[model samples]
Target: MGNDGSGAGDGTKATEDAESTQVYRTFRRARDLLLTHREDYAAAREEFAWPEFAEFNWALDWFDRIAAEERNAGRPALWIVEEDGADNRWTFSELSARSNQVANWLRGLGVRRGDRLILMLGNQVELWETILACMKLGAVIIPASTLLAPADLRDRVERGAARHVVVRDADTATFADVAGDYTRIAVGERVPGWESFADARTAEATFSPDGVTRADDELLLYFTSGTTAKPKLVRHTHISYPVGHLSTMYWIGLEPGDVHLNISSPGWAKHAWSNVFAPWNAEATVFLYNYGRFDAAGLMEQMDRCGITSFCAPPTVWRMLIQADLTALRNPPRKVVGAGEPLNPEVIDQVERAWGVTIRDGFGQTETSVQIANTPGQPVKPGSMGRAVPGFTVALVDPVTGQPASEGEICLDLRSRPVGLMTGYAGDDERTEAAFADGYYHTGDVGTIDDDGYITYVGRTDDVFKASDYRISPFELESVLLEHDAVAEAAVVPAPDEIRLSVPKAYVVLADGYQPDAATAESILAFARKNLAPYKRIRRIEFADLPKTISGKIRRVELRGRENTKGDSRATTEFREEDFPSLRG
Candidate 1:
């Protein structure tokens, strides 16, 4: 009896520890390889191996390995909290057991391998439960942010060919408009036509695998942010994301037992990129805090309290975070990274001054993982997104000449395809073929590379404009505009010009407590003219809100359209390079 009792206690403790510490160690092997080969991107891209598993389920294989090895060894697998102070922390082992229950329960409800399930929920426990359970059951997950409107839901249901939906109780009404013959399971109080997710807790904790999981099976279908055209359906294989975020693991500098908090919406690719895959790849704890509006101080407080070791946020969030007292938190994370868009150098400088830590920037999209990053333990070049990440072969292809150039559209070599590349845009073969033309996976975004191979921010090929025969990048002008004291935000777009064909027109949003007047305008225009070349000067100005897409990208296309039609609006202030003789000189 004593021996048996001791064994039970040890087993119990082992489960807890495995749930906490094991994931980090397992993720470290690949992280070590990434760091060691950071400088040798070509070799790493050629030689890197995706961890081979014959009977692999990332949740079962990698996560279970941690459980068997680590005994209460580290921390919880996931930690979430609300602004009101409600919180939940689940260990890896606990999550594993809970997921088993969810999987079994969902299976009983008729979920099967290859079944498409639309998971629409907020930052709640059901989201994680459904994610793991679906993974174990081999159900394809179409993650949806609760932010989607009912109309958007209909589009997703039809486009995804969904067979099941696991959603919040209140959100069930959304399906009233989105009709489908699908299994509807709701969390919280049971709604009519929806099964209660609460029942899953009663099922058996021990889950048995019904079949083998192929690494190449479709796991995630992303409805990308439609900046221009309709949202493209992006298909990600199990290994493509689960195993492919190894590059993201390297970019964020995640190590064993690190606590990583990535600021992103639940349904977006960036969320899965960090919260699920990258952290799990590094065995880092995924930390999340739910809030109504962004509170930079609150985020820093959470960072301090949680001892968050790594952080990643979009450039938009970083811009907001920098506006706050960045030094208030005495201890910042060991690593900080910016994504979504190229970061302005002004934001990086402020953070470095306050935190004594440089903010690293990286480049990638919904179509791929981290391709370029100013990584940990490396020198950061302001305005330059560092070298290409390990395992990605990047080339700058001149569109005009159809050859590699110092400045051109960034393309990935298809001959040496990285595991991080997407399978293709779902059901869009022609578009996919066009994307992979000329033995390269063209990224569409244009940038420049120096002799040393460091890539710098240039506007998108479509976004760049010519002013007096001098090409101007809106990002470049916008960066300079941000440095001025009167400017909170700025968007530079081409306005119609009778002589120069096109001249730089800047729409400025004044910083807090600044008045919009001729003085402020002259200050901004003078600052731009002084810093920029004569032809690249900001010739026209407007004080107005910048238009943005739903996903928060500046709609330069909209601004350009306005210039074409409403160029005569009295709101616009036109200045000529000749009007300012000093600028002409």
Candidate 2:
């Protein structure tokens, strides 16, 4: 047997097959160990090791094997419920066969090994099918968001060197101006110049790889959210995401047959993190509730009706969820986690009171998987994002000294490089070298570590500033502001001051039923003064929507720029602390 699905191969191929089997067994052993010690974080960290392999194809080896097993083949692998009351489900066996057909069809259309393909689609069945098919076919995938306009599409097509694009039929027009020779394939209704994704149904249901896939082969290219600057291309190998997500599975506490719901949009790294790799790695069902607009009550209904056992959501969604009637759902998920940003303590406290499950926070980036997290059964300290996950060695390095410290930049020690980390920034060797320089992958984010090894996020290196010569963490002040009822969301940036070099200014988004008036500003400012230190208090507030990346991360860089250019002038919406005499203590 060979990796190419040929039986009774020559001596070299037979030897290759034996190596492949050993790799599979080693990977399975690691996965099973984590599952066994799911709640025992200490045992898991001390025992777990990343499986090493020379040649490995996760889709061909792991997923296909699980699909053929009698115990797992019939289990539901994907469950999607739409807002219009449409429901669809697919078993492991079905997706395996469907992906095979898609692979064969794609190969016929010149999608060969090493070809770069842009996958832009919603939470549809075709997305999963195509992803599996691409893996089997040994094609590199560049996942793009549908919200991208023509200019953004052009950047991906040109910079990514994409050889093909599979997107929604309606979006085909956006590509008209994106000049490229890439093959166009559209889902949904037919387009004149584009191949219909529906045609895959008529292709052969059995497929075979043309050659063996090395574990180090390029697999996924993700564009960073670009909160501060232009998006950088992050590259991952075949083993990095597929095998490395074992840490993610353990962090989420996923188990076999568990139905997990992760609230995220397609075309982002987090979507693949939870929606595809993490859940499937644990042999759990990936459940999704697709909606045009986020309705907290409606989403809760689906979670109850579908029996979602594990849930993962961003901090933004978690904040909105708390505003709704949380008790409407009869059953809440047993396992819950928050990512994308450091969740506020107030939000976590509210969720725990309503549902009895603490919202554990995990920290990572587009460059890596969950590096630090509050794992299952761990004592989650308020405002801390837990400890280093298994298989990762995390350190806080002082920026000036470049040495390990108690409070500094959060970094990953590359002495034992984790499997979930990306290879480097694609097409930019200089940036890649800078990131991996000094024997550590600098995360560009700052944090503090306690005596117990728990790491709490402070803020991005560029986002942290000084106020009256005292270090100011915007996240800390924003957390206090979020504790107020008048604040739906808040962002803090440094504003120029004459007496003190700079002062903390807050941009607040009022919650429902709250007016963005002088009274509301005073209430929020007074609350911050009561909770935070005087130096960290929000001295000025402006009621306005936060500027964010399309991925929903607040772009504090933009707010900082706005404040710098404003000089001494004040906007109509701005309110200063001096305007209220009562708040002066």
| Alpha carbon lDDT of each predicted model | 0.81, 0.92
Clashing pairs in 1: 17-71, 17-72, 18-67, 19-92, 19-93, 23-283, 24-283
TM-scores, one per candidate = 0.90, 0.98
Worst 10 residues of 2 by lDDT: 1-10
Q: After superposition, which runs of candidate 2 have C-alpha atoms over 4 Å from their true positions?
A: 6-19
Overlapping backbone residue pairs in candidate 1 total: 7
User: Model 2: per-residue lDDT, tens digit, 1-585?
Assistant: 235664445776778667767776888899999999998999999999999888888887888878888998679999999899999999999999999999999999999999999999999999999999999999999999999999888888888999999999988998988998998999999999999999999999998788889889999999888774678999999999999899999999999999999998899999999999999999999999999999999999999999999999999999999999998878999999999999999999999999999999999888899999999999999999999999999999999999999999999999989998999999999999999999999999999999999999999999999998899999999999999987889999999999998999999999999988899888888888889987898899999999988889999999999999999898888999999999876
- The CA lDDT at 20 in model 1 is 29
